[model samples]
Target: METILEFISKHIEMFYLIILMIFVGIELIGHVPSVLHTPLMSGANAIHGVVIIGSIIVMGQAHEIISLILGFIAVIMGTLNVVGGFVVTDRMLEMFKKKK
Candidate 1:
């Protein structure tokens, strides 16, 4: 466990870059089947809700004010994306509703 922690501590930035790349790859090439895409995307949107809580967690561990500020910004962006995603999804569903 200590060895793993040491390795991670030594390679924090590389791990971050690799994770970022993986997510980018997922965005670019991880096509979902039509039937599952909307549901998965909505589920993914729910993930953004974690950002604000993450910011608070980060704030507790922050070594500098800048880190706190950046965390706050991330929280704001994540919240906006979560809310906007839901709103757009609702509009899309409404488009398909049969009108009287």
Candidate 2:
């Protein structure tokens, strides 16, 4: 849509920063050993909670139906991701716990 295009144009710098960060994150993760992946993913899940909040804000402010629907879906997916990440992290950490 025209509005989306205009918004993206106006915030092009933000988009560039986001893209750059994505690549940087991927590169960093690529170098991490398998042992550290669980902790890293747990941290990412906390960060994704922020994404859910952002999506909620978008859903609240979205005037167009399509935008609202997309935002809602984003929130749902983010929630699922965060919850799953925490569960996996907990299971991984449990293996290291000493017997009582």
Candidate 3:
């Protein structure tokens, strides 16, 4: 674990690059058409579900109160986002259905 932390500290530039890439990726996603947003959001929500799983794993391994609290918050927020995404996607699809 110490080795990992040392490596991260040594390669902090890589982390910065990754953060920049993430922001750029988010900006590019914003350029997607309105018609595509719902599907993309649903996909993102599925990814967030994976994030929740990771957070749960982290929570299980957490030894400190602060880490536990942060992990729990991550799980809760991810759940809310996923549920909200599904609701929005469903509503968007409903508009495309032929009305009786």
Candidate 4:
């Protein structure tokens, strides 16, 4: 408990920044028109693809157990995000196809 408090105190600014980003992201996303969602998600997918590669590199270089674990989790989450984004984008694109 003491260690957690110390850690939080040490990184208080980072925590605040993260909280601020979350709120800003929520507001920005909420205001995006539905027509823009596909393009936005494609951009996000590209970003997450980079994240997945970076996480894999981190996992390969990680010597500590905690670092390895966190890197693995990051890779998994990034992969999921990328795959889900592609799936959604594909479905969205399908809607534009004319009937057979």
Candidate 5:
């Protein structure tokens, strides 16, 4: 467990990015039915929110200035992707709705 944590701590940025890419690839592969795509994407986007908040916590705990700064940047970028993705997903869903 400790070893896993150490590796994760050392390579957190890569880990976060890999997870994000996996979600994106899943979305791109068209496994989600069109009817469920937006909700699925929105749900998946929440994962980024977790990454952002987690990075914030890590930044607060970090002692090294460089790591702290990088973590802070990660928080901002991750949050934008999460929130903006949800908004975009919602719009995509709305586009499929029948017009009045």
Candidate 6:
């Protein structure tokens, strides 16, 4: 569609930056040691908590149905990510404890 193409053209640089970030993130994460994973996951969960709060604020301010729906989805997904991260971190910590 012309509109889609126009939108893509208008934000081509952003697309390129996103692609670059994806690759960089993959490379960085792939190289992280397993011992550091728990800490990294905790940090990621903290970031997602902030994202969830921000999405809630956005949803509160949204006047359009579409915007509110998208914000709600973002909040749900962010909360899931944070909860999952905490669960995983807890399990990883358990693995380090001595078994009685």
In angstroms, the error of model 3 at 49 is 3.7
Clashes of each: 0, 0, 0, 0, 0, 0
| lDDT of each candidate versus the true structure | 0.75, 0.83, 0.81, 0.81, 0.79, 0.81
CA error at residue 54 for candidate 2, angstroms:
0.8
- Candidate 5: which stretches are off by over 4 Å? 1-32, 46-48
Q: Which lDDT value does model 4 have at 6?
A: 100
The residue ranges of model 6 lying beyond 4 angstroms of the native Cα positions read 1-39, 42-48
Residue lDDT tens for model 2, 12-50: 999999999999988878888788776777867766676
Give stretches of model 2 more than 4 Å off.
1-37, 98-100
Off by over 4 Å in 3: 1-39, 42-48
| TM-score of model 4 vs. true structure | 0.53
Question: What lDDT is obtained when candidate 5 is compared to the true structure?
Answer: 0.79
Q: Residue-wise lDDT of candidate 4 within 29-96, one digit each (tens)?
A: 88887887876777567555667788888888999989988998998988887787777777766776
Best by lDDT: 2
Clashing pairs in 3: none
Model 1 accuracy (lDDT, Cα): 0.75
**Backbone clash tally (model 4):** 0
lDDT for 52 (candidate 6):
74
Minimal lDDT window, size 10, model 5: 29-38
Instruction: In angstroms, give how far residue 47 of model 6 lies from its true place.
Output: 4.3
Of models 2 and 3, which has the larger lDDT? Answer: 2
- Pick the winner on lDDT between candidates 2 and 4: 2
- Residue 28, model 4: lDDT of 77
lDDT of 6 by residue, 16-99 (tens): 999998898798789888887777777567555666778888888999989988988998987887777778777776766865
- My TM-score estimates for the predictions, one after another, are 0.48, 0.54, 0.53, 0.53, 0.53, 0.53
Candidate 2 least-lDDT 10 residues: 91-100
